[model samples]
Target chain A: MDIWFFLIQVLNGLQYGLLLFLVASGLTLIFGIMGIINLAHGSFYMLGAYLTFWLLQSVDSLLLAIVLALPISAAVGYLIEALLVRVLYRRDHLDQVLLTYGLILIFNEAQRMLWGGDVHGIKVPAALDWSIPLTDTLSYPVYRMAISAVCAALAVGMYLVIQRTRFGMWIRAGASNRDMVAALGINVNLLFGAVFALGAVLAALSGAIAAPISSIGPGMGDTVLIICFVVVVIGGVGSIKGAFLGALLIGLADTFGKVLAPDFASFSVYAVMAAVLLVKPRGLFA
Target chain B: MTTFIAGTGLHTYYGSSHTLHGIDFAVRRGETVALMGRNGMGKSTLLKSLLGIVNPRQGKVTMNGADVTGADTHAIIRRGIAYVPEGRGMFHNLTVREHLVMSARPGNDGRRDWTYERILETFPRLAERLGSLGTHLSGGEQQMLAVGRALMTNPDLLILDEATEGLAPLIRREIWHVIRSIKETGIASIIVDKNVNVLLGLADRHVILVKGEVVYDGSDLTPESEILKRHIGV
Candidate 1:
C-alpha cells in the first residue's frame, strides 16, 4: 500500500467522520437531553439538502442558502416539538419510537411530493472548489478539507458551549435530572424545545454542507440516519465528545473497508460497533 | 408576617390513589414551617402540591398573592420558590460548582444575597469538593450541596423534602445549624424531616400529617406533648 494512497484515505475518512459527527451530535442531543427517540431526525437532514438545492437555485449562494435554510428547519423542529413531541415526553420509549417512525414516513413522502423522486446535487462554491495535489495521479478537494475544518470548529464550538456557557450547564443538568433543573427555576420545557430545535439545525446544517459531496434523493436520509444511530450508540447516547470520536472511528473504518474490501464494507462498521459494545456496553466515552 | 405561600383545599391523587386530602398549608415570610409525617402519609405530596410538582385535583395555591394552581414547575420556581427535593435530587454527572452555578440567579426581590462565594463560605465542605461530581460525593456532602444549590436561586421560599433523611448525627446537626442560619437570613422555608425535636426547636410552626390530613398544626406544643406521642410516635 502506497503511503500517499493511505494518507488520502485517512483524509477522506476524516471528512466523512466529521460530517457524521454533525449529524450524530444532533441525534445524541435529542436522545440524551429530551429523552426523545426521533426517527424523523434524518428527515431534517433530507430537508436541509432539498432546501439547499431549492434555495441555491434561486439565490446562487451556498452560504446564503444555508443561512436561510437553518432557521426554517429550526422552526419546523420547534413546531414539531410543540405539536407532537411535547405530548410524548412522559410517554414510553416504544410510543416515541412509533410516533417518530410515523414522522419519518410523513417527511419522506413530503420530500417526494415537494422535490419528486429524483437525485439532486449542489454546486461547490467557487471559494472552496480548488483541490490539493496529493500525488501525480491523485488530488484531494479543498471542499472536503473545508468540511473537516468546519466540523472541527463545530466540535470545538460545541465543547465551549457545553462546558463554558450557562445554557450548556442547564443542558448538562437536564440530562442528569430534568425535575431538579426545573425546581431550580429553569423552564425545562422551553429549554428542551430550544435544544430540539438546535439539534434540527445541526442535522440540517450537516445535510446542507454534504449536498455538494453526496447525491440527494428520496431516501438519502434513511441510510445516514441508520449510520448516525450507530455513531451515537458507539459514542454514548448523550455525549457530544463521544459522538466526535465515534464518527471519526466509523468514518475511517467504513472508508478503508470500502477501499480494501468492497464486499465487506458495510459489515466492517457494524463489526466495529459490535466489538465496541462487547467491550464497553455504554460506549467508549459514556 | 406577610403570607409567602398559601394552599387551601388541596386534594391531590396519584393515579386514583388519593394522597393529600383537602389539606390547608401556609408559610409566612421568614417563617420556617415543618411538614412532618410517617412514610406514605403525604408529607412530601403536600410539598409537591404547593410547588405545583403534582397537580392538585382541587386546590388554590397563591404565591405572593398570585394564583398558581397547577402552574408549571419552572414557573413556580421563577415566582421565587426553590425546592431541594427528596433524595437530594443530585445530578450524577455535574460537578459541585456546576450545580451551584447552573441555577444561580439574582434574588427576584432585588437582593443579591447568595453568590457563589457566599455559598462557598457557608459550606466550606463544598468548596473543598468543588470539582467532584454529584455521584462522587458522600450523602452528607450531597445534602449540603442540595441546600447550597437552592440558596443560589435566591428564592423567597425554599422547600426541602426529607431535609436530612439519612445522615450521621454530626452531619444532621450541621444541617440543622445550616437551617438555623437560613432562618436568621429571613428566607421562608418549608422543611420535612423525621427529627421532631430538632424541628420543634427550629420551625416557627409545625404541621403534622396523618394519612394525608393535617392532624396537628401548632407552634406552642412541646416535643413531649401528647399530640407528638399519640399521632407521630412509632
Candidate 2:
C-alpha cells in the first residue's frame, strides 16, 4: 500500500477511536460511579440518530438538530434514572442486568414503531461536504476530520472537568465511597441523575455525528454497544484515561484487520481484548 | 445549651440481628461527647442511626427540635454535621487537596469559619502533601487529613469514628491535639476511640454502650470508676 493510503487508513482509525471514546467514557462513568450496569445506554445512541433524522425534516442544520436533541436525551436519561435506575442501585447486579436488558427490548420496539424497519441516511451538511487532497488520485473527507477534532476537544473538556472542577471531584470521590460523599453534604442521588443524563448526551452526540457517514438503520446501536463494552473491559471499569487508550487500540485493530485479513475482521477487536486481559486481569487501569 | 441532635427509642437492626436497642442519645451544641464501648457494643450503630446511615427499624432522630427521622443522609449532613467515618473513609483516587476542596462548604448558618487556608495552617503536614493521593498518606497523616476534611465543611458537629485507630503513639497525640483545638473553636464533636484516658480529658460528657444498650451516661466518670471497668473493660 502507498504511504498516503496508509496515512488515510490511520486517520480513519483515529476518527473511529475518538467516536468510540465518546460513548465508552460515559458508559464507564455510569458503571464506575453509580454502580449501575446500563445495557440501555446504546439505545440513547440509536435514539440520537433517530431524533436528529426526525428533526432534520423540520430543521435544516445538523448542528441545530443535535443541540435540540441533547437536552431531550438528557431529560429522558434523568427520568429513567429517577423512575427505573434508582431502584436498582440497592439491588444486586443480576437484577440490574435483567431490568436494563428489558429496557433494550423496549427501546428497540419503540424505535421500530416510530421510525419503521428501514435503512436511512443523513445528508452531510453542505458546509462540511468537502475533502482535502492527500494525493493526486486520493483525498480525505473533511467531515471525518471534523468529527475527530470535536471528539478530541470534548475528551479534553471532560478531563478538565473531572480533574479541576468541584463537581468532577465529587464524581471521582463518589466512585470510591457513596456514603462518604453524601456525608460531605453533596446530594448523591441528584449527582447520579446528572451523570446518567450526561452519559446519554454523550452517546447521543456520537450517534448524531456518525449518522452523516454511516447508514442509519434499526439495531445500529447493538454493534456499537458490544464494541463499547469491549473498550470498557480493556480500559478498566472506571478509568477514563484507560478508555481513551483502549478505544484507539480497538479502532486501529478493527480498521486494519479488514484491510489485512478480511475474514478475521470481526474477531480482531475481541482478540485484542483477550490479549490485554491476559497481561492485566483487572484491565489496564482498574 | 441547645441539643444539636437527639435520638430516642432508636431500634436499629442488621438483617434480623438487633444492634441499637431503643437507645436514647443526644449531643448538645458546642459540646464534645465521647461514645465509648468495646467492639460490637452498638456505639457505631447509634451514630449511624443518628446520621441516617442505617435506617432504624423504629426510632425518631431530631435535629434542633425538628423531626428529621429518615431524612436523606446528605440532607441531614447539610444541617452542619460532618463525619470522619471508621477506617478514615479515604478516597484513593482523590488528592489531599481534592479531598479538602470538595468538602469545603459554609456552615448551615452561613459561617465560612473553616477555610482551606486555615485547615492547611492547622495541619501543616497535610499542606506539605497536598498533591499526594489519600492512599499514599501514612496512617497518622491519613487521620489528620480525615479531621482536616471534616473541618473544611465548617460543621456545627464533627463525628470521628475511630479517628486515631491503628496509628503510632506520636500520631495519636497529634490527632488528640487537633481535636482539643477543634473543641476550643466551639464545634461540637462525637469521638469514638479506645483511648479512654485521652477522651476523659477531651469529652465534656460520656455515654457508654454495652451490647446495644447505654449502661452509662454522665459527666463525672473517671479513670478509676467501677462502671468504666465493668462496661468498657478499661
Candidate 3:
C-alpha cells in the first residue's frame, strides 16, 4: 500500500480503536471487579442507538437528541442492573451467561420492534459534520474524528476515577478482594451495583455517540460487542489500561488488514489476538 | 457508649457442612472480647454467622437489645455492627484514600466525629502512601488499614476475626496500639487473635471455645494473671 493510503488507514484504525476502548473498558470493569460476564452489555449499546434514532426524529437535532438521551440511557442502565444484573451477581457464571444471553435476545427483539430492521443514521450535528482537509480528494469526516476524541476523553476520565478517587479504590478493592472490603465495613453490595450501573452507562454513551457515523439498526450492538470482546481478550480482563491499548491495536490492525487483504480482515483481528496471547496469555495490558 | 452484642444458641452451616453448633456468646459493651479456637474450629464461621453471611439454622443474634438474626448484612451494619473478617478482604486495585471513602457512611453511625482525616492521622504510614494499592502494603499495614476502615464506619461494635493471625512482632504491636486507641473511643470489639499475652492485656473479658461451644468466660485480668495460660495458650 502507498504511504498516504497507509496513513489514512492508520487514522481509521485509531478511530476504531478509540471506540473499542469505550466498550471494552466497561466490559473489563464489570468482569474484573464484579466477576460478572455481561453478554447483554452490547444491548445497552443497541439501546443507545435506538434511542438516538427515535430522539433524532422527535427533536430533529442530533445534539439535542444525544443530550436528552444521555440521562435516559443512564436511568435504563440503572434499571437493567437493579432488575436483571443484580439477580445474576451471586449465581454461577453459567447462569449469568444464560440470563444475559436472554437479555441479548430481549434487547435485540425489542430494538427491532421499536426501530424496525432497516438501518438508520442521524445527521452529524452541522458543526461536527465537516471534514478535516488532509490532501486533495482526501478528507476525513469530522464526526468520525469526534467519536475518537470523545471516547478518548471518557477513557481519561475513567482512568482518573480509578486512580485518584476514593470510590475508585473501593471499586478496585472490591474487584480484587471483596471480602476484605466488606470486612472493612464497606457496603459491598451497594458498591458492586454502582459499578454495574456505571458500566452500562458507558456502553450506552458509546452507542449514542457512534450513531451519527454507524448504522443504528437491530444488530449494530452485536457487531460492536464481538469486537469489544476481542479488545478485552487482547487487553487483560480487568485492566483498563489493557482495554485502552487493545482497542487501539485492534482498531489499527482491523483497518489496515481490511485494506491490505479484504478477505483477511476478520482473520487479521483474530491473528493479532493470537499473536498477543502467545507473548502474554492475558493480553497486552491485562 | 457500648452495651451487649451477643449471639445466643447460634447454629449455622455453609451449604451442607454445619459449622457453628449452638454457640452462645456475648461481648459486653465497651469490652474487648476474644473468640478463640484451633484451625477450622468455626471461629471464622461464627464471625460470618454474626454478619448474616450464613443464616443460623436456630437461635437468635442480638445487638444492643435488637434481634438481628433475620437482618441482612447492611441492615445489621445500619444497626451499628462492623465486621473485619479473616485473610483481609481488601480491594487490591484501590488506593488507601479511596478505600477510606468507599467505606465512609454519610454522617456517623453514632460517633460525633470519626473522619477519614482522623484515620490518616491514626495510620500515618497510610497517609504517606495515600495512592497505593492494597497488595502493595505489608501484611501489618493491610491489617491496620482494615481496622482503620472499620473505625471509619463508627459502629457500636467492631467484629474482627483473626486480626493478628500472621504478622511481625512490631507490626502486631502497632495493631495493638490502634486497637487500644479504638477502645478508648468506647467502641466495643470481638477480637480473634492468637496472642494470649496481648489478649490478657487488652480484653476486659475472655470467651474460650473448646470445639464450638464456649468453655470459659473469665474476667478481671491483670498483668500477673496466669489463669489464662492453660485455657489460652495450650
Q: Best candidate per lDDT, number? A: 2
Candidate 3: RMSD to truth: 3.0
Pairs that clash in candidate 2? none
Better of 1 and 3 by TM-score: 1
Tens digit of per-residue lDDT, candidate 3, span A1-286: 6666677788889988998788789899999988889998898888877887788777978767777777787787677777877777779999989988998999888877777789787778888869888778777888888888888888889999987777787788777776666655567778887887788778888888887777777788788889899899999888899999999989999988888899888899899999999999978766
TM-score of chain B of each: 0.97, 0.99, 0.90
Model 1 CAPRI rating: high
Best candidate, DockQ-wise?
2
Per-residue CA lDDT of model 2 for B1-234, tens digit only, reads 999999999999999899888999999999999999999999888989999999998989999999889999999999989999998889989999999999998888899999999999999999999999998999999999999999999999999999989999988888888899999999999999999999998899999999999989999999999999998888
Candidate 2 has a DockQ of 0.90
TM-score to true structure, per model:
0.98, 0.97, 0.89
Determine the backbone clash count of candidate 1: 0
Question: Residue A265 error for model 2, in Å?
Answer: 2.0
Per-residue lDDT tens digits for candidate 1, residues A1-286, read 7998999999999999999999999999999989999999998899899999999879978999999999999999999998999999999999999999999999999988898999987889999999999789889999999989998899899989989888999998898889888888888888999999998998899999999999889988889999999999999888898899999999999999999999999998999899999998999888
Clashing residue pairs in candidate 3 (N, C-alpha, C atoms within 3 angstroms): A166-B98, A169-B94, A173-B91, A179-B89, A180-B89, A180-B90, A181-B89, A236-A286, B3-B29
Predicted candidate 2 versus true structure: per-residue lDDT over A1-286, tens digit per residue: 9899999989999999999999999999999999989898999899899999999999999999999999999999999999999999989999999998999899999999999999999999999999999889999999999999999999999999999999999999999998889988899999999999999999999999999999789999888899999999999998899999999999999999888888999999999999999999888999
Candidate 1 backbone collisions, by pair: none
DockQ class, candidate 2:
high
Task: List fnat, each candidate.
Answer: 0.95, 0.98, 0.63
